[model samples]
Target chain A: MGVVVTSPQFKDNARQAMADAPLQRALGHVRKNFIERRAAAAAGLPEFEALRDSARDIKNHTLAHLDLYLEEWERKVLAAGGHVHWARNAAEANRAIVDICKARGAKTVTKGKSMISEEIGLNDALAAAGVAAIETDLGEYIIQLRGEHPSHIIAPAVHLNKDQVESDFRRVHTHLPKERDLAEPTALLAEARAVLRQKFIEADVGITGANFLVAETGSSVIVTNEGNGDLTQTLPKVHVVIASIEKITPTMEDVAQLLRVLARSATGQEMSVYTTFSTGPRRPGDPDGPQEYHVVVLDNGRSSMLGGDFEDMLRCIRCGACMNHCPVYHAVGGHAYGWVYPGPMGSVLTPTLIGVDKAGHLPNASTFCGRCESVCPVRIPLPKMMRHWREREFERNLSPAALRSGLKLWAFFARRPALYRLATRLSTKALHLMGRTKGRFAKMPLASGWTDHRDLAAPQADTFQALWKQRRETR
Target chain B: MTARDDILANIRRARGVAGGEAPRRAAVEERLARAPTGIIPARARGDAAHRLALFRARVEAASASFATVADAAAAPDEIARYLRDANLPATLRMGADPRLAALPWAGTAIEIARGASDGHDLNAVSFAFAGIAETGTLALVSGPDNPTTLNFLPDNHIVLIEAADVVADMETVWARLRERFGKGALPRVLNLVTGPSRSADIEQTLLLGAHGPRRLHVVLVGAGEIGRQD
Candidate 1:
């Protein structure tokens, strides 16, 4: 929210990331680590597959009867002395949060990492209204200082290196002595800690995103390694939790089952360091906690997903497991998606949330690689969902006219086996003729983007369908 | 438009596909009634030693320090020495547990505070209620003696642990907690401290302390019946 990088579209962002040698190298290194660690963690448990299936079924059941669960959640929260405000969309959610801040006369707001806040762009609205919003999460704070959106959901500043952070710190912390060495990790942390301590004490309002909402107890769960979340929620007088309505589970047992998969899939840990749950405002005899607890349940296009084809997408716990395993996400990284959410799940959800006009390029970013779906702890059929989005985009006439016509022509022939076989044979002959050397096409009429990065291998003289026909005739 | 109208209008717009009856609610009561009361995995009792070793390796990997003591009485002195060696002051806040409070430390120069106060003055020491061997986690329950502030506000945290209380897995630890406190019970704060506060936010560089304790020291007490024999 500090500064929007509006110059780059999705294509432009992808090109830039691909061209940057350092970023590509870093992506390669980090992506391998995540994939390898997750596989090792999954292999350790025999019931991991069964657990995924069960988790998926539970999420599906809850989402199918979301209205009933939501009502039950609202009643439980209110009974626990907490207030639940329902927001229809981003605008309503943002306006409601700002209004709450205004009523409390809040000047400074501290926040724990909540993707819902990012989805609503709440900080931008708060800053415009003269309220200083501070990101308490270390990763979030770095990105906030850099004036950029989070590139990765879990590790926001995973793309940055030490020197970049050193420069950012020097620019922000002018009070520090110029001679003070910022080369080491210790020094950088000390500087950030000193700065955030003051913000924690001064902030009047605290906001956080819930990892899970236990409907039975009306408690919002936050899992983090650093204790910044605890400080963010406890230090302020008024606490606001912005979460999607689908985050609620029936009971703590359901929460336990989800947590079993959540941490193991995320960072290969048995459990995250801190899994703190808060029911409501500070009770009597409590020494320190928020006085006013407000939970803003933002539907924001998710409720629409409940009974629709994309309902399974709601089961995502935002663990970043699917993104970590995605081939395209590894190649292009998160910024290429050009939205709040990115990666495989982002491809399906973004188009649905923002409409195809804004995010039509997302679904095409995938290779239909089943890696993401295979690794998903909740078993979201990501590739199929992406295909659905592509289908919707074409139906809405959102795609370019030429591309739509090309798809139509291909579909026409694809339906007729004889015409499709004939077309394939002719194209194979033409490709062989064009390739005089070992099969590699430098440029193609329709696929310039593919050839621009690397040469595409030319097809053989005989198509697979033609070979099948010849074999049958000979037999 | 009124507030209710505005809310309803937003809901209508956000709703995806309508016209279908709501799905039938699944019967959770029947499932819970038939579900197993416990699912604790069986392991050899000798495996506790191996689990403790693995837990230590993980804690070290996370960049925390651990030292095994012969007895709880030796822990206070050893901790005082560690603080002194680290250039930290000897002032400490002790938990309310009588076993921890009774440790004789006449030879040690450290001054023990009776209860939790502002941790800004110096180091705070407390006895962990239980140690989880699975994730190298220490459970801290707040009571009259164990003020939650000692867990956070301090720069350095030193925890005393009994070797016998170390459980081999998280499920085992949870079972113990359930037995101690019934289903409806929850403390104001149930802290599961795993290593010291760490962050990789700044350019993906690992920083030991972002906001919480800069250093975490664990004194594993192997005394009396709790001591693990070599």
Candidate 2:
């Protein structure tokens, strides 16, 4: 795997995350802001849902014809005097990028927030090869300063409060006056801006992740609120774009449809401040742009995903809506999923990218509230996919023996309706009689996990089926 | 097989395609050839005057400064006023865009330098290829006429948008682009800038001028009921 997988220990990570005060304080921002802003933005647009359907259709069309589109895009890139390298995995992708920087003798490389770069661990790889990789995105830069992985995909530092960020800056930037009022976000932003401005001008190679790679024009599109991506690609001598195979869109019109929904879904904005469509490098007689343009096309297990049950995941534009509206994500936060990705989308995708065996705990983490699917811009069935992961886990016996045995016992009773009804009726009657004095039980047999947090409500005399039968009989 | 061939083969296998099927090929080719327009919002479907109004309102909403001029010849003066109002440098960097070059820059004392941005210019101007009313976006195509660097390097970016070039939505913008840069080809870069550069990454509090221009002032030229030309 490109990044280390602590996905197997997701339960422990989630437990730790739930108890972390600073992270919990930080997650409150995501919970309050993203939902309201997105709702307001969507409510203001009458065609928002219709546009989502259109965006989904376009992505589906592209993926179905991905082979042809990829071929066309490659041809167009080559025609436009750009270089395209195909990578089977993260290692190859990193190598291709490192070699490009080396060939240019790039001492420093400025980066625009690319999840692909994170997935490939390009920073460490570049550092190993003696190249300084500078993260120009504010969120990425902060996390990079802390030697931490991004929790949220879109807002990488969504896990940190302003105080935490101020401390991080203070710790790293010792040359600055310690007593400078780094209290406000504005002051912090200004500091980062001043710091990164020099790096942007000095870097030899610039790398950015593509939101969409247009097959029609051979353009790699990046949508960002900050203009960091534009400057990163424009000022540098060499520009490198790293994107997964599934990022392809067939045409500009298709891109338009996707872009309409992307910003609204991601950050609840009409459009991100900078939506750049970069074709080749600089043209003849053109001044002040990259001299060389290189695109590293990474497969990294996505091709196999297209043919499977998880193909719907490929339609994702990385808007982070699925995770944003997710109740489980809100509770445990992103780091709990314990990989490059987190939340419902990560649960489904991590299994495919890494493997269900390692990431089996992710799908089990969801509460199936279905908020993720409802807010999904492309209408990806995130919960359904997570269920699929659970099934796969069960099929492969990746689930614990106790869980398997419990399910087996339930299945034994469920196979026979009379036995199931009788068993449930008896249990309910006993519980009702036992807990008549109290409405709930503080502890219950064989269900300590449920009772440890809060008391389970005692069942009434009648089971749900019995109540239904009685109602039907009386009516 | 090479990685590319292997990946394609895998995709083909997963999609249950033989890779040479005529219907699939035709569908793929047709979609690319047609470049079908998708669901454009009702808000973007309005009269010329209405769209211009919407464009101004949206531009302001996105935290960009908007100004209207009577003609292209009035752009430089308007730009000069904007720089002066913002208390920015009188000197500006620009490209060889004839529309911009034709502006009566001599009317103002602002120093004008040509070519592209070297990351030192405090202010830069570029003539937009088109503007989208739905999001108040400036679609700038890269070339010698309007180098891409001028769009990002400066602290204040003053874009000269002809009122006539403002379109209803992004779809129309694409159609216009296809017409300008042939089918399946584009300029080196096409930047769709909505307001100034901003970031919410610092504790998710919105702050402008994170890396790009802190001030994005638009000079809308040639007023009146200017309908879609294409």
Candidate 3:
């Protein structure tokens, strides 16, 4: 893979991320912006919850019959004179894309924001094949200039401040006026738009990601607010869509259901500015648009996830709502997760794609506040999936020795209720008496990791079991 | 084995079924043949008048501008007026749509250009196939009639939507599309544009006119009622 897997050092990565001042400032935006906007959008529509359910069911049904849907989609794509390339993994997916681009002798290709492309490391693959891919999404463009992956799926440059963007623009875009006023976000946006517009017109190939692939009509749908996706796909001679197998929907009706919840959950817009459904190459007598249409249908370990514990994860639409609502994500930002995806969804999804041993910390990073599942448009039961991963990690002896011993020690007493109650009662009384003066512990043995960040609240004189028995008997 | 076969085989094996399951195939074919509707929002269940108002409200809320004309003939004047009021150029780009061509642009001083845009035009107008009221979205099909480029490559994109084409929900738009394009088929590009181009990529602050049109103005003709009746 072109991208480095930093998931193994997730703890160290998170520690470094927490210490970065600019990153902390940038992460403040994720907390301040996404949560309120999503809540407002959901509150505005009465059927928002029902729409989420419908979206989930549509994805579930499509996945259950995924083989049929994929075959049907491929047949329709062929019927429409479009090419379908099946990729079993990331390398194959990138191979198909590079071959398509190289066959046309493309020097430069403009790209829309697509997580599938990131997952497959397509840009790195293209570079190796002597092709340059220009990211057209504004957020993607900024991070691309910095030689970084997207911090968030939808908001790629959410971890960047305007000042940082200003410097990046000044540093990279030297041909522009050196004294250009780019202190404001608007000026930076104008510059990027001007620069990318020429690339859009000049590029030989255009690659995009699909939000939904319709099997009935053999169309690929892309939803974008900046209209960059349209420009990327429409301007080039060849339009290549990179999407996973689970993106397929049964029909346009199902697409509508998903779209209804997508923008609301992601950006709080009633609808994105542009949602384009492309069937095939430019038709006969068409004035503009691409001449060649190709879709790279990738499995990438998703097909193997079916009928498994991670099957619910396949229904995810990549809306980023889970990350937006996640407190851990808000604290560390997406980079700490060390993958294209981050937050609760990544916690479950990352382990499956890259082995559980590598991504073990992602699942354990969650606060288990259940906000992600509550806000998930498809209701993927994120915490439940994370727990499953933890179980898998422990069963394989992947967790630390201390954690395993602690768990085993607790389980030994928990199996015997009398011993467990006595142990808890004695421990709580001893700790409460010791901490009675301060009512909290700033430092403690074996728990300094937790206390270092914040003082640990002292335990009470009695366990919850004893308190519950007393209350029930008195009642 | 080929990648396609391998992937398909893996999925089938995981699901504990061969590709020849008649029931599964039938279910897939049935869903594809009959694209059924899902739970449409109650907000879209209003009358046509309410639909028109909601369409205007939602479209405006999406950061797009619109004006109502008494008839199709009045659209050209309104278009000119909007352009003049907004201080935009008098030149307009469009396709050879007969509906737009039939309008008497000779009465105005506006310069009219024809065919799809090559990214140089500042103002462009395309006729929308449908206007969905649920999210104030405009569905424009790609062909010679309304090139997809015009929908994205202009500074000011002005679309003329007939009152009769306005629908309450996206599901209805699907029905209209199927009726026109036939089942299991679609145009090269069906663009559902709600507002003008915008981006919040830098510091989560929204900026308009990013890589696409800076302004999207809708001219709804015959706006008093839903159908052709005055």
* CA lDDT of each prediction against the hidden true structure: 0.75, 0.89, 0.92
True contacts kept of each: 0.32, 0.91, 0.95
Docking class of 3: high
- Measured with C-alpha atoms, the lDDT of residue A31 in candidate 3 is 94
Task: Show model 3 residue runs off by greater than 4 Å.
Answer: A471-475, B225-230
What's the candidate order when arranged by decreasing lDDT?
Answer: 3, 2, 1
> Which candidate ranks first by DockQ, i.e. highest?
3
Minimal lDDT window, size 10, model 3 chain A: A1-10
**A337-379 per-residue lDDT for model 1 (tens digits):** 8878888988888877777788888888888978889989899
Q: After superposition, how far is residue A240 of candidate 2 from its true place, in Å?
A: 0.7
Taking all chains together, each candidate's TM-score versus the true structure is: 0.88, 0.97, 0.98
Q: Please, what are the lDDT tens digits per residue for candidate 3 over residues A242-318?
A: 99999999999999999989999999888989999999998899999899999999999999999999999999999
Q: Give model 3's TM-score versus the native structure.
A: 0.98
Where does candidate 2 chain B have its weakest 10-residue lDDT segment?
B221-230
- The better-scoring model by DockQ among 2 and 3 is 3
